[model samples]
Target chain A: MSDRDLIIDRYKDLLKTYLKGKSETALYKGQQFSRKLIEQQISPDDVLSDHVSVLHELFPDMSEELKDSFDFLLEVMIGYGFAYREHQSLRTRQRQLESEIEVAASMQQTLLMSDVPTVDGLDIGVKSVPAKKMNGDYFNFVKDHKSVSIAVADIIGKGIPAALCMSMIKYAMDSLPEQRMQPNLLLENLNRVVEQNVHPNMFITMLYGLYDTDLHEFYYAGAGHEPGFFYRASEDRFEDMFAKGLVLGVSRQTRYKEYQLRVNLGDMIILLSDGVTECRTSKGFIERDEIVDLIRAHMHKPAQEVVESVFNELERLQEFELRDDFTLIILKRKV
Target chain B: MNIQSCVEVCNEWDIVSARQLGRNMAKELGFGNVDQARITTAISELARNIYLYAGNGKICIEAAEKMGKRGLKIIATDNGPGIKDIRKVMEDGYTTSGGLGAGLPGVKRLMDEFMIDSVVGSGTEIIATKWLR
Candidate 1:
């Protein structure tokens, strides 16, 4: 037989073995055959034809079904080779998206206040849990020698956009002049800042308070925030501090309502986002009485314990996972 | 294919048992591997929602024959104050609390069928299903 015919005959035998189980050897032999054919100036089509003719001649006992199966295998191999490349590209894209999300979540963490500010005559504690990696709800406290300000705000949405809005709020709050001590003025200024920067569809609910230790007074304003709960230990009852206002970014002219309370000894002030009162329970829903009970049970404990107990009870009632972000801040006055 | 299963626990860590039960039900209903993952994620979302939002709630997994194929159903019922606005809850990025508001909406996107019934000052019931082809 001629050299070309010899090469084809050897390749056909290797192909049969490769199909049977010796895939590696078959692949090596096929590569060798192609290199030899290329050196001899043989076209790929001619090499394929020679391979088929040699296979038929050598396997005269092979059935038509076997020939069809070989053809199918060849098609599958070629298709799979392309599919493997496409799969790799898709995996790279998915990884890129995941990394982007991770970066966004990290940035969100920076936007949140890492530690509550320390101030005299105040025992303040705050806790937050994100349903996702990042949260749009945030609470921050800034204090100087004269006054202590506590700010709690919930951005209207979640994810990167809400996170961005949260950051904007934080920056604006940090940049505000110390003279902006009144909660209503602070909220009005924040509203203008948010309305100028945030998306029109998005809004924020904020509760800003300024407490003066020397004067023993607390002044607060609500910009569509939930009514905070005040446990006046002297009265042995919980009273709702209801202050109403339009949500920030809803309208530039929105008016925030300001309220004042005497900061008496042994009184506890609780400010929470919707995540607390909106908490669900197995029996049906969490009512104000249940919340009071939870507080009363742990009120005698440390401020941190009270915060943890509220979360613990909420977890017990749901007996499942949290659906939204949960944030709570507790401020207690020492007797 | 009427199939129902339930698990009860007092602690938050026990949530995993509930997740496994739901995943098993989805698998037994003939859901593919991908379908199983989706269902498991949805179940986790709802279960977490119950634990975090409602405090304590029951999870119910049911399988029914729908569109001539076995369908796995999950219902997370909670006596929480329920959602004040279903539309806002469904809206992407809209969260009453903080966090990335992806719980209910994420579950809605993952399942083949989704339904939410919530009454303010009442409770919330979420039903989601996936069909095995």
Candidate 2:
């Protein structure tokens, strides 16, 4: 017998046993038979139709109203079957897409991974977390004998596209060592690359800075990125280091303005994404001053602890639900 | 021929039903495979926006004709928290939901003509049309 016929026969036998004695064993068998029916891909309509047929065969005088009700239930089951199959297919497709994105997200992590290099005169601490599986924020460090270059970039898109764009930026930065030291020149070159390769609808905001150990100064440039903060230990004040430049991919001829800051002893320079400054809470956004004060409260700690504390405070205010990708880098002059 | 169908947008299933209705209507109107897919996708995004942002809304698809050309029209209406900055939402890469940031702009690009009317306190309405070439 075909599988369908076999399932129907088994179901009919179970029904007969249950009607004969109303035994618990028969009900248990019925449950087991239902599992078989499910495994055999039996439709509810088919089961109902078979049940009505079996009941008529056993009674030979099933009531007309009861038969009509079975027919109505079968009709409803047919509609339910179609919707059930559609939902299953949609669920399968969603699972496939989710797995693909998960794979891509892991690959992004492995490929664009950068080690936070230990500089001789600076204590560096960095943390980046994605609000989703795929991150729109990217940060990298390129270290050499004379300087350590830091780049923080945020894509205007999300998901696989943004992750792919960030990977491209990482590879591009890796291939270019000539423009690594000059912040303005590096951004100008990266902007051209982004303009040429990235989609027209997408753009990126980036901040590139290089700290020269010999001169004890930081040369920084921006491309519509969130401004960083400068903490002067001698003055015991914080200043927002704003730079004027257009976002990448907007224009090929865009020029990034470069600025330099002399790093006094025990001073700190902070680089971050808008996700840090715009951390949303139930009250509203966490203000820049609040973030600065949070940093001040933990300034006595090590660089890593300070970075972690600031992130912890902001994350707590948002109840640990990140609305955007968070990236923060703190470079404190230790030597 | 004039046919109008409206699908309530309350959950993910409603988005699927709205897209299915759009696809069937496009087929009945003799729209080719490409235009049918575009119309279906546009409806899916619009319906999803309603489900995601407005919580519950409705999608209306109708057979349209203008200037002697056959066309299809889609209207998405929502009474939830309306969009505050319509212009900013229309811009590509602008999203409050942390999506790919291509919701409204992507729909506008898919349809030949798109119009959005939104009031912060009241609600939002979007009408999009695509003509058969």
iRMSD values, candidates in order: 15.9, 13.9
Which lDDT tens digits does candidate 2 get at residues A1-335? 88667766787888988999999999998888888776666655557777877887888887889877765566445444433444444456689989988898898888887899988989988888898998889999888888889999999866668888998999888878898888999999999999999899999999999999888989999999999999999999999999899999999999988999999889999999999998999999889999899999999998889999999989999999998889989999988
Candidate 2 accuracy as TM-score: 0.63
Winner by lDDT: 2
Query: Chain A vs. true chain A, TM-score per candidate?
Result: 0.74, 0.84
Q: Give TM-scores for every candidate, taking all chains together and pairing residue i with residue i.
A: 0.55, 0.63
Model 1, range B1-133, lDDT digits (tens) per residue? 3657875523576478777897788767676444565576677778877787777787888886765777888888888878877887775555544434245765776677899999877789999988775
Q: What is the lDDT of candidate 2?
A: 0.86
The residue ranges of model 1 lying beyond 4 angstroms of the native Cα positions read A1-62, A66-89, A280-285, B1-133
DockQ, candidate 1, vs. native dimer: 0.01
Which residue runs of candidate 2 sit more than 4 Å off their true CA positions?
A1-62, B1-133
TM-score of 1: 0.55
- For all candidates listed, what's the TM-score of chain B alone? 0.88, 0.94
- C-alpha lDDT values of all predictions: 0.76, 0.86
